[model samples]
Target: MLDNFPFYLGLLIIILLLIMLANKIKVAYPVLLVLAGLAISFFPGVPVIKIDPELIFFIFLPPLLYEAAWTVSWKQMWRWRRIITSFAFIVVFVSAFSVAIVANYFIPGFSLALGFVLGAIVSPPDAVSAGAILKFVKVPKTLSSILEGESLLNDASSLIIFRFAMIAVATEQFIFYKAAISFSWMVFGGVAIGLLIGWLFMKAHKYLPTDANLDIFLSLLTPYIIYLAAEEVHSSGVLAVVSCGLLLSNNRHRFLSSKSRLQSLNVWESLCFILNGLVFMLIGLDLPEITKGLEETSLMTAIGYGVLITFVLIISRIISSYGAVIVTLIARNFITVADNRNPGYKTPFILGWTGMRGVVSLAAALSIPVYLNNGNGFPQRNLILFITFIVILLTLLIQGLTLPYFIKKIKLNDIYDPVPRHEAANHLKQELAEFVLDYLKTNYEGQTEHNPSLQHLIQKWEQHIKGIDNEIISQDHKHIYLDLIIQQRKWLINKNKEDQTLDESIIRRQMHYLDIEEEKLRYI
Candidate 1:
């Protein structure tokens, strides 16, 4: 471990540099990190990095999924439940079986079960990757919410299918009824365990002393505990973590102290950044190890297989997305209580196009057994790993890089304008100010000791109300004030983009100040 210190330190430095470069070039940092890791793999003195599948499933996955779930809006998730569920479960099943059939027909010795394994491996798109890219490009909130909700839950379905596939491959038996029962149990049990754990944790936080540091520490531990507890009972640990996160996040405003909430956000954000960078880079570094023993299959042949399967995966997603929309439209006629907000064609197209695979796919591929129960070697194991890696690389490079352009071409940003947001915020502020002034005047006007303070507070609230009501000065002055702040923020962002000399921390600090100023203006 001590001997690896220099290497780890150097890796951290490289990740930082790659992130800066990504910001300058307006590309997602994960893409750059993967490229950097791939480049570093060929360095003369560097040792090959092997990814531990267990580490990813047990360590990295829980927290990442939990953090994502925590940040997602539960209200939006409810509104888009039908769309999200269709994408998460139905689309995953469709994509998996579709790829399975294609892989079985195309690859010489690949069994149908193994094909399903590969399908399951590549079925779910990485939420982290999508979230990171979406952060830079402005998409509609509904689209973002749908993508986020689908990603949060799809892993459970994918992994469940993967488990059944692995069992079928190893035992040479498939039991459909038993598998269906087990799937339901896993999902429902996971949710029950998660809600129980989340409720217990919520009680603890509510009753405990309000120590920000302690609360943050507990927040970090929540995911791991929830995951382990659920998995111990053979339940879906992924669902458990996600459920726990959503429950806690939904209740955070009521139970958590303000300082704890702020500190926890900062802590989680930093942790996510480091983990995401490391995971993507690790994906690239593992390429050398994954390709080591592929002497049986020619590289070109494997590449051909990968390209075919990648095409299949993309096409399957596109078809499934539209199919889902059509099915929803038909079902809406019968189910009157369903979400009636039709997402239209463009949204589904964008959603289908964003199905880029990431680290989880690689981890699942790597986890494939080396030997079967009959003591024979796992058929085409190395080739499967190789193909999986190729799919990851192709999708990340091809789909991830071009998704923003597609969003722009569709004019999604323009469609989801911020004018309504500003209007609603201003309206809320005016109503709040008016309510406060009315309460003060009615309750405290006759009190002698509180008269002066009450009058002063009432005047302040009235002045704010008047300022909001004053249309002539309000519109022009507010616009100028907002414009100046926005201009300064843009300059800082552009400086960071143009010259890589400025530290990202400086830009982040400046951006934070601008955000605060903009937030303050919402009241006026």
Candidate 2:
């Protein structure tokens, strides 16, 4: 570990520079990181980073999945459950089988089971990639929510298929009934374990002392604990982490202190940024190593196969997405009780186009055994790895870069502007303010002497409420109030920079508080 320190440090520095470049150029950071990694791969003496499949599945996947689960809005997820489930489960199966058939037909010496294994490897659009890319582009809230939800759930489905396909390939046998039973057990058991762990942790938070540091530490441990426990029982650890995160996130206000929430947010954001950056870059770095073992297949043939498979993957997803939409439409016509909100052609098109693969696919491909039970080499393992890498590279380069342009062309950002949401948010705040004021006046009108701070806070809340109400009635006042808050925040930041006597942390804390206030004014 110590020997690798310089290498790790150098890689991190490169990641940082790439991130800065990405931001400056207004491009997705992952795309830039991958490009940087690919360029560095050709440099003399740059060592190939061989990623262990176990490390990815065990170490990297849990926290990333949990963080996504925690941040996803449960309400929105539930609202879009039908669409999400269709994409997560049905589309995964469709894509897997479609890829399997196509691969078996097109690629020489590729068996159906081997094709299914490749299908499983590439089936799920990675949660991290989609989230990272979408963060930079403004899309419809429903579109974003559905994509997130699909990514969260699809891993479990794809991994299940991958496991069974691996078993079938190794043993040369496939049992549908046994696979179905195993799948059910894994899904339900994983969810049960996650709920239990989440509940236990929630109780611990409530009973334990309200120490923000300790709370943050426990929050970090939650995902790993859930994942390991579920995996130990042969369950879907991915679903376990996701479920635990969703449960805790939904109930965060009940147990987490304000400081814990604030600290945890900052910690998770930074952690995710570093992890995602390193993962994407590593994907590119591993390309050289992945391509080196293809002795039997020529590079030209491999490239042709890769290009053909990538096309099949994209087309399969597009067809499945539209087919699901049509099925939903037809079902709604027949059933009285169904979600009536129809996501038009544009939404499905975007969804189809956003199916970018990432690290998990590479990891799954790498995890394929080097040899079968009979001691013969695993059929086309090197070729599978190469194709997987090619798919990831092309999708990240082609789909990831083009998605922003498509969003703009469709006017998704303009359609889902935050203005209407802001108005609704302000209206809700106004009602909440009125209720709080009424409660305070009813209970503490004659107790101002006993609680001066309470009275002052009440006054501040009242003023804020009035200001928002005024802004709603008069549009010009909105800009005026927003500008004042912005100026105040800038003044505080500049003052903090100039003041040598003040502690930096103190200044930062005040700035953060001001930021919350400013965001509220600007958005609400």
Candidate 3:
């Protein structure tokens, strides 16, 4: 490892600002940062910095996965367990085996074992990529949940397969029965370690009285605990990280105090952004190193190979999704009153197309062992990395850019409107507001004939309710009034006025309480 602190620091600062701009411009931050990094490579007097792939996986991935898992709802995730399991377990293994078939047939000098290795790495979708792109899209909750859950769980399955694949490649030995037994041990051992560690962590939090900073620090440590525990047992650290994230997230309400929850959220959100930026930038930077190995091959040949590999990767995913859908449908038919209905033909097709390759693919490609024994370089290492990068750029930059238009063409937009959902949510808010007002009126200290202001406020709320019932008030207009309420509350809080304008004070307090309440309302 080289220090080159000045160069690395300058690059990081530039990347941070560039990422912020990319977000405002509504472009994918990863792709943009990657492009910027690629451009940086050509600069005069730039020193090349080499990093170990092992460091990135061990140091960076756990926290990122933890952040994603923490924010997702356990109940919602559990509801989609069937589809998640199908995608994570079944889809991953199928995709790996399918890619192995294609790779063995077409790619020269690439072994079946190596093909399976590539398959394992590329099978899991990147959580960061999914989170980033899905942020701006208007997708249904079920679809979003399926994507996130799949992203989290597939990392484990992919790693498990990759482990076996690596063993076969390194030892030049392959046995289906041995591989199956090893896979079971790896997966179950990782899961058991995660559960035991998570339980211990939860119990520790109970003894450690909840404080904002303490909880935030603990939140940071939980992922590393899971990663280390799993690794100690030679299991998939990725799975352990994900499982621990889920376990801790599910118990946060019970173990972490409200203040601690807010602090932890803020901490993790900031951490995720920095980590994501660096990872994407690294992906771009590594492209130069990958391209260096392509000097011997003709440009046309390389492009042809890249295209063929990309096609195989893309097709494997699409075929696997369709297969999973058919199997799930058949399984559902046997159950009485099973609610796991398939989306209309169009939705599954749309989902199949949205399976874009990204960071996981890039990382896996680069992770290909560069040296084996007897002075021979890792077989097809550079080629694997090159093809993987090409596939990621094509899927993420090309298909990702076109996804919104595809959705529009297929009328997926009409199927996934936020407006109606927001309207229903607004109705719930109004009802809650009324409930609070009623409770205060019945139980509060102030009830007087002298207070004309109090009576006017009550009359205003009743009239508002009447207007809502009569369809005289629009949800959009009510949203505007809520904005005014927020502004008024902010002004009062800034002025440190607890008792100014009695009705407004009560309203402001209610708004403050609701602000706290809505912390639990996290969703796309």
Candidate 4:
């Protein structure tokens, strides 16, 4: 581990730069980065990098899961909560069972337990692929929300199911009732543990003196804490990390000071970016091991199974998505609890096409036990890995590459609202005005008897506020342009504060000057 650190660092830098360039071209960074890594692996002198499969799941998964959970807007997720819940819980079970049945029938030697393991491996939709695929593939905003929300939660569910199957295989005993009870405890226990930890950390932060560096250090520790705490109780660590991340993110202003906020944002963003880059690069680099697996099985047989399973994987998802949407609509029609707001046919179709397999699938496949009977190895491990590789490659290359075009053809992209620039500008103005008024009232009251100059300044600021207010209301037609002037004034206030060459009074004076200039610009 010590000696290989330098090689991993070099790989990280190369992959980060590649992803940065990929972002510029508006291609999905992960897809392009993985493809780039795959291309690079064929070159001479590239070290054959093979990571421990379990390491990827336990080490890499927590932060990636946390990042996705952190960035997902709670308000947006709440808007389609029911659909997300259904997809996460219901769709996961359906996919797993569907895959198990198909795999059992096709693979002569594959046991139902092993088939279920494959199902669990592929059941959770890839969060990385969802973000990457959605970048170019425009879908209805609500549909995209559902997909993202499902991806986030389904990871936890499928992981629980996967572990259960692994244990069942090891013990040569499968009990449906026992598994169901254990799964429930795993999920609830994970969530309860996460919330408990999050609360403790939040309370601890209140006593700590405000420091951006220290706050970031605390933020860095959160996911690891969540993972460890949940795992100790035989629960899903991924879900725990995700839950903690979500709780902290939603209550960001409560637990984190502005300085801490900036630091935490920077730390997590950089951490997630590097982690995402490494995962994708590793995906590409794993192709050599996959090719080696084909040596055991005949080339033609390997190709046939790969192609067949890939089809099953793709078609299963599409059918499930379509089924989900239609069922949801039909149920809503009967219940009348709310409007159908069916994002229409195109939204579901785009979703069906966009269920591309990625990092999680590969990680799960690699983690499959190589040895089952102590020293005796598990049968068909190579074939399993090969099939996993084929499925991932086909979905990524065939579906991911072409999903954007299909989305365009179907015209499901119109639901998204452009950024509310005008509202943001207006909001900034209101905040600035409020700030100036409060400062003038408090300072002028204190200084009026002693300082004549301060009194004059207070009177002038009151008039300035009124004039700006009138200008905003008078030019309704040009509110967008007027708001821009207010936006610039807000920026100047922030700049003056940053410069710190002036005291609060001096900054207020400068702000007044900017406000007047803004008013004149609004008129022009």
- lDDT values for all models: 0.81, 0.80, 0.69, 0.71
TM-score of 2: 0.87
Kindly list the per-residue Cα lDDT of model 3 for residues 1-524, writing each as its tens digit.
25688888898898889978877877667768777877887787777645467657778888988887776655556666777888888888887887788888887877999989878877776667666776666666657767888888888888788878888888899899988787887788877788788888888787867567877777788888789878887887877777778898766545765556666667888898888888878777776677888756665677777777667766777777777777778877786322454455667665666666766667666677778764667787777777777777767776566666666577554544333555544554465546535643664326525555455545555664554332132332344334434443444343333422122223334444544533432320
lDDT of 2 by residue, 424-512 (tens): 44554465456556655765567656665555656765886786322232233445334444454455455445643223334335445
List, residue by residue over 340-382, the lDDT tens digit for candidate 1: 6666788778989989888888898888889987899988889
Report the lDDT tens digits of candidate 4 across residue range 1-524: 67768877888788878777867776677677778778878988777867577667777888788777877755557656777887787778787888788888998677888788888887776778768767765455556667777888988888777888788778779888988888888888888888889888887776767477877877778788889889888988877887787787766646665456555667888887778888888888878867776656797787788788778777877787788878888788667522355566766677677667777877877887778866667767788787777777777778777776776777644443232434434444455565655655664466567765555545544555554433322233244334444554555556444643222223334444554554465356
How many angstroms is residue 271 displaced in model 1 relative to the true structure, after the best TM-score fit?
0.6
Q: Once model 2 is optimally superposed onto the true structure by TM-score, how far is the C-alpha of residue 125 displaced, in angstroms?
A: 0.5
In each prediction, how many residue pairs overlap at the backbone (N, C-alpha, C within less than 3 A)?
Answer: 0, 0, 0, 0
For model 3, the run of ten residues with the poorest summed lDDT: 499-508
Give residue 265's lDDT in candidate 2 (0 to 100). Answer: 83
Model 4 spans > 4 angstroms off: 1-9, 136-140, 334-339, 373-376, 413-524
